[model samples]
Target: MFKRVIWIGGGVVIGVVIAAKAEAYVRANTPKSAREFVLGTDQDHVAERTLSSLWGQFRTIMDSREEELNRRYIDRARSARH
Candidate 1:
């Protein structure tokens, strides 16, 4: 019975030590941005804000490209008509 208790206690201690080490390793290796995104108060809106900003930039670029393409096509058609 004493031997069994000692084994159980040793197992519990080892498990705890392993868990702590794992937690520390993860914390140390985690990226700062990821940690901030996870733990920040603005976590809920971070993704939404990021996506919105990205979408806005994409739209702006798309519009600019479309305008350039249309201008080029019109110019080419005009030149061909001459």
Candidate 2:
């Protein structure tokens, strides 16, 4: 059971990575208008961007939020200790 679970989890990770790489390749090679048509997005600006770009932006926002949350938690902990 444990080995089966590990195999399934590994397969899922590999599949997701392959899919992401394929998507990045398509996003890079496809024309802007074609990509926009496929994505059905009204924004003309994002037509040229790849998943990596969007992921970077998302990661930045998440990191900032995490830092803010950590700061708040530390402050609360210190207050409680006093």
Candidate 3:
């Protein structure tokens, strides 16, 4: 009787844990915004927005790095010659 009770309790705990994990997984994958819900926006729109933002950031970083390289090399060389 004690062994059976222990087994049942263990099963219940495992079931609860599995259910909680599934809920979390679903929530994490679903979109969170009211606008998205109203607009019926899909995953593709979310991905495109993310990619566009990332591209903008990349361009900003690239421009800054190019300016730094020009200052470090071209400006220094010109100053040395003068």
Candidate 4:
């Protein structure tokens, strides 16, 4: 009975210690913000760069003529407002 109690108490303490260590390890390793680790550390103009990077990568799937068509459509839409 006494030995079982000691074992349970020791197990709980060990578990707590392991959790604290793991949390510390993760805090030390992981960045607070994703942008700091991925695109850049700077926060300025992130949305534009993020959109451009994704759109540029997606544009690679289309052929040259398709890309030109897309550009013309986008430009015409912009020009139509003037």
Candidate 5:
């Protein structure tokens, strides 16, 4: 029984030490942006860039569609005028 208790205690201590080391390593290796996020800093630049890129893509698509519609309208108007 004593041997079993010793083994269990040793295992628990080892596990705790390993977990602490891993936590430290992660905190050390984390990027500034991610660390700022963990500290509750306002890191909206990433979100803003993503939203801006998506909006740009959407505007490009809409502009192409608008140009196609305008070309079609102009063709119809010219034909009717003739």
Candidate 6:
């Protein structure tokens, strides 16, 4: 079970890297289409910007939020322990 979990997780990481590289490639080759879509130019633009970019953006946003929540949680936990 543990091995399978690692295998699946590794596969997911590999897929994300390939997709991000692909997205960066497409953005380089097709900036007008890829770049324009990031804005509110078209509804489909929301879907066109590869999952990796979206995930990368979300991961960045969430990491900050997670750190904040962790700090608060630790502060509360430490206070309660006293």
Best prediction by TM-score: 1
lDDT of 3 by residue, 13-37 (tens): 9986885675456557766674456
Write candidate 1's Cα lDDT for 1-82 as tens digits. 9999999999989986885675466558888786565545564455477668889999999999999999999999999999
lDDT of 6: 0.75
Ranking by TM-score: 1, 3, 5, 2, 6, 4
State the lDDT at 54 in candidate 2: 70
Candidate scoring better on TM-score of 2 and 3: 3
Candidate that scores best on lDDT: 2
Per-residue CA lDDT of model 6 for 3-75, tens digit only, reads 9999999999998788667656666776586566554455345446555688999999999999999999999
Across 1-82, the per-residue lDDT of candidate 4 in tens digits comes to: 9999999999989986885675456557777674356436654555577669879987786667798999999999999999
| Higher-scoring candidate on lDDT, 4 or 6 | 6
C-alpha TM-score for every candidate: 0.50, 0.45, 0.47, 0.39, 0.46, 0.41
Shift of residue 12 alpha carbon in model 5, Å: 45
Q: How much lDDT does each candidate structure score?
A: 0.77, 0.78, 0.73, 0.73, 0.77, 0.75
Question: How well is each residue in 12-74 modelled by candidate 5, as lDDT tens digits?
Answer: 899868856755665688898776766336443544655688899999999999999999999
Pitting candidate 1 against candidate 4, the one with the higher lDDT is 1
Better of 3 and 5 by lDDT: 5
Off by over 4 Å in 4: 34-82
Residue 74 in model 5: lDDT: 100
Candidate 5 ranges beyond 4 A from true positions: 1-44
TM-score of 3: 0.47
Q: Which pairs clash in model 4? A: none
- Of models 3 and 6, which has the larger TM-score? 3
